[model samples]
Target chain A: MNFDEIYSSKLALVEDALKKLMERHKECPPTLFKAMNYSLFAGGKRIRPVLLLSAHELVGGNVEESMALACGLEMIHTYSLIHDDLPAMDDDDLRRGMPTNHKVFGEGMAILAGDALLNLAYEVFLENAMKYPYKLERHVRAAFVIARAAGLHGMIGGQVADLEQEGKDVQPDMLYYIHTHKTGALIEAAVRAGAILEPIEGDVEDAVAKYGQKLGLAFQIVDDILDVTGDAASMGKNPSRDEARKKPLFQLCMAWGNRGVWHGT
Target chain B: MNFDEIYSSKLALVEDALKKLMERHKECPPTLFKAMNYSLFAGGKRIRPVLLLSAHELVGGNVEESMALACGLEMIHTYSLIHDDLPAMDDDDLRRGMPTNHKVFGEGMAILAGDALLNLAYEVFLENAMKYPYKLERHVRAAFVIARAAGLHGMIGGQVADLEQEGKDVQPDMLYYIHTHKTGALIEAAVRAGAILEPIEGDVEDAVAKYGQKLGLAFQIVDDILDVTGDAASMGKNPSRDEARKKPLFQLCMAWGNRGVWHGT
Candidate 1:
């Protein structure tokens, strides 16, 4: 298969796995399950999970062994979106062309839903690791990489910085910190975790890490640029909110505008 | 040492471990770090961690080996408290005789702090587990137990139920469900995780589980009763709020008022 064929096939597998995982959780309260499912099944492109699976395949790692990790990465990504749209955060009313979790389920359940998703992500990771005890060390290592990326030093750290820098003149150093930590960390984790599932060869893991870091930053810059250039219908969410809220945008920074030259790294 | 001495020593050790964990993350944004530290070091008794250590000792689990799990449990407990006090949730202004996390750090930071703590908890657990690769299976099992207790099947499940049933006339079964899931799950998980750290022998694990469930239920009932009987000065927060909000409370249920009889299984 070519790149698109492999990507499409991997995406289908992730969707199937995620659907089964949600079905298993239907015994919880109807509202909570629905709230989680509504967002999980919302028209996300499954970029992070796809990245993980693709990277795993690139390294000749067993795709079956890394399925849970990929699904868990998607869950972490979803939970962050749910929390980010809360009234205290970005207060977004729409996500992926649907009402946000808080808008549909109310703020309290949305908050709990996000918490539950995060908890369930770890639950899924640990459960899968326990099932394959011989490979438990690799699973633990992968989970640690993902956890650190999702925690203070990674995604959440970037979010806090972004929140603080909102509507203020942000230094270039701070802008890089916010973008890299917020958007880049988890993306980097996806690739590194995929590669780590197989034993590391000399320089392979380091090269994979560098690739992930660059991919993550490029992904965020493109996303910010889309917010400036894309329309609401195509983007699913309103493209103007970030600019209206005066968020630190790559397109707005004149000092860093030399498109092909990476200055702040 | 007697029970009191053992308890105090364990408590001291947990506090120290938690403090060090917080100190390590000072490189994150200052507001985020302070928000997390504020709620973490709040003056609540370290009941969950103590329960874990006590149960570990009862099962002859290595105390040194279980330290990270204890601190991780505390982080989960703290994160739950921070989220529960959000304006979207209980909206309380005070916790443990001081301002709540959101009140001090603003709602966005508080939310991120809670997310950071939860992510950090898993990080600590995985990091500790990896250090003892030979014992990795046991750590995975224990972590799975905690994750389930904190996820939709346990604490978050109960919280959702409680939110849905608020200010409504609830049946005894629903009340029991809410209490068991919301408060009892983590408490039970504490004992179970502690015991699982060591290999189980015979009926001991079953007996420990029963003890945990009953103790958890009893602990919550006593807390509800304290709200009715104790003063705000003693309780550290307003005692009237739960009743004002018409939350389901054990003291308000008349059908189960025969104090000696266990009404629901």
Candidate 2:
């Protein structure tokens, strides 16, 4: 299949798997279920899961075999967005052309919904890993990669740095740290996890990880550019959000005269 | 060892492991690390971790071997507390004789701190489980139990139910649902996880799980009673807080004339 066809096919698998997961949770408290469903079903490109499936497929792994894990990655991504848009965090009222989760469900339920999504991500990972006893070790390792990327040392760590840098004269190195940890870590992890889940050679795994890292950094820069130039109609949220909040951006850092060094890194 | 001696010794192991985990994260952002450590090390009885270690011991597992998983359970418990005390939730200011996480760290940091703790809990679990390749299946099972107990079908489900019932006339069945899911699920999960981590027989696991379920219910009942009857000096929180919020409690449910049926269930 060509890139678009491959991407569409993989996206379909992820969407189907996520639907099944949600159907299983239909009996949960109505508000929590609805809130989680609202944000999860919100339109966004399934980049992380697509990256994971692409890497896995490149290594001759079956897309169906790792579909649950791809869905788990998407759940984690959705949960992070839900929490980030909370009144306490970025405080955005819109996401992907819809009112934020808290706007419709209330703040308390929003918090619980985020918590439930994060927990269920692990539940999905563990449940899927358990299905293949013979490949249990690699599965555990893949889950570990995802966990590390999502935890304090990775995405959350970067978030802390970013949150602390709000309205401050952020340094170039700090900006790099924030972007890498917050965005690059998980993207790199998705690719690495895919390689680890299959019987891949070490060099190939390293190459894929490097590719993911570069892609992640570029992705963040594009996001920063879009936030400055895009409009609400296309972006589905206010474009001036980061600038309004004085949230640090890669473009701001690049203007600080470290562009060459950053590109080298 | 006698019960007290065994409990004290297991407590020491868990405490030591937790300390090491904190020390490892000292290089992370200072505020996040401090926020996480503040509540994690706050003076409170280590019930969940203690239960996990004890259950593991009862099933002939070594305390030292399962120490990390026990600590992970404690982290999950701590994260739940941090989130529960948010202004939008229970709105408590004090916990275990100190300012709550959000009270000291601000709501935004407090939210991130809680999210980090929950993520780290899974990191700890997956990391520890990966250590024993020969026994990987059981370890995965143990982590799965913890994940399920903490997820929508377990603790978070209960929390949603409780949140929805605030200031309302709650039914006994609804109260039962809240108590069992919010409080009892993790307690029972700790015991079940302990048993699963070892090579225990199936009947023993069932018996231990049943014991955990009863203990979890009794524990909630005692907590409700304490909320009404205990002093601030003892309980380390405002005694009337739950009552003021009109929180659904076991005692209130009992007063609804389902005491006999509740006990039988």
DockQ of 1: 0.87
Cα distance off (Å), candidate 1, residue A232: 1.1
| Candidate 1 CAPRI grade | high
Q: Which residue pairs in candidate 1 collide?
A: none
- How many clashes (backbone N, Cα, C below 3 Å) per candidate? 0, 0
Least lDDT summed over 10 consecutive residues: which range in candidate 2 chain B? Answer: B256-265
For model 2, residues B1-265, the per-residue Cα lDDT tens digits are 7879977877777888899987876777889999999999997578889998889888889877788888899999999999999999988888998889998999989989999999999988888887888889998999999999998999999999988887777766787888889999999999999889878789899889888887887887788778767887888886645454345564565653455434634
Instruction: Quickly count the clashes in candidate 2.
Output: 0
Query: Over the stretch A142-230, how does candidate 2's per-residue lDDT look in tens digits?
Result: 98999999988889889888888777766667878887889999999999998888998898999899888888888977877787778
Error of 1 at B24 (Å): 1.9
Q: Which structure among the candidates has the greatest DockQ?
A: 1
What candidate 1 gets wrong by more than 4 Å, as runs, is A240-265, B244-265
